[model samples]
Target: MPRYLISFEKDAMDHIREEDFPEVTKAASAVCQEAEDAGVFVFSDGLSYDDGDVEHAVVAVDGMVTDGPYPESKELIGGIFVVDVPTREAALEWAAKVAVACRCAQDVRKFRGPAGV
Candidate 1:
């Protein structure tokens, strides 16, 4: 089975009021449960909302480690779901369910096999 990544942008949750988070979370959790029940779920997790808390590391050519959010991305990953499925269409279907559950758009990508095979 091929694994697909389903992810959401960080800014999408910025406008959600604290009080409403529980409901939104409930909906999203339900989707995760569904994925598990279907046996397609590999892993799922959410990122911390505080960007300041994130430590980005860069490994130099000589293996020196530097810390910072490199590449200066305008968007951050809010959450992610790794699902192993049979086809791209199946992945897209899962993404759609996730988007609705999360109340935000989702970005889907297929994982490259080992050694890019």
Candidate 2:
């Protein structure tokens, strides 16, 4: 088994209206529950992107702290699921389910090194 991260960018869900969040949350939660039932889910969470979170992210360089993200990057992980799957194909299949549930595209990548499989 290998661990994979299935995630989406914050902006990827920007097109969704606030009123639709409940439904989207419900659908996404259902998928998470399904994964849990299958014993593939290790963790799942939605990251906060509010002014107090992303806007206030700190970067440290040579012991000096800097505010905000790297100047070259604007995308942020909106949500993620850490799953222990048997193969890349299985990870992709899970990502597909997450994409449909969240109504957005997803990015999947395996954890590096031993992955604690």
Candidate 3:
């Protein structure tokens, strides 16, 4: 089995209003449940984009400690699921389901180098 990361950028969900979040959450949760029942789900979570979290990011270089994510990339990982599936097609199918549930595009990529490879 190969592991794939199905993810989306934070801005992808920006169009979703706070009032509509519950519906979106329900849809996304359904997809996660489907994946779990299908035995493909390994782990998944949505990253926090709160200003406090980002502002407090610790950066260390040569024992020097600093705060904040250096370079400050415009995009951030909004959500991700690690799934162990039989093939790329299977992963894509899962991604499609997720995209529909989240109402956003998904990026899918396989993990590097299988065990002992």
- lDDT winner among the candidates? 2
Looking at model 3, report the run of 10 residues with the lowest lDDT sum.
52-61
Report the alpha-carbon TM-score of model 2 versus the true structure. Answer: 0.87
Query: For model 2, how does the per-residue alpha-carbon lDDT over 19-54 read when each residue is reduced to its tens digit?
Result: 999999999999999999999999999887677665
The residue-by-residue lDDT of candidate 3 on 84-111, one tens digit each, is 9999999999999999989899999999
Ranking by TM-score: 2, 1, 3
TM-score between candidate 3 and the true structure: 0.86
Listed in order, each prediction's TM-score against the native is 0.86, 0.87, 0.86
How high is the lDDT of residue 115 in model 1?
A: 89
After superposing candidate 1 on the true structure, give the runs of residues whose Cα lies further than 4 Å from its correct spot: 49-54
lDDT of each: 0.87, 0.89, 0.87
User: Each candidate: RMSD to true structure?
Assistant: 1.9, 2.4, 2.2
Distance from true location, Cα of 117 in model 1, Å: 2.5
Writing each residue's lDDT as its tens digit, candidate 1 over 1-117 gives 999999998777777789988998899899989999999999988977555764557677898887654465677788998999999999999999988888888999999977858
Which ten-residue region of model 1 has the weakest summed lDDT? Answer: 49-58
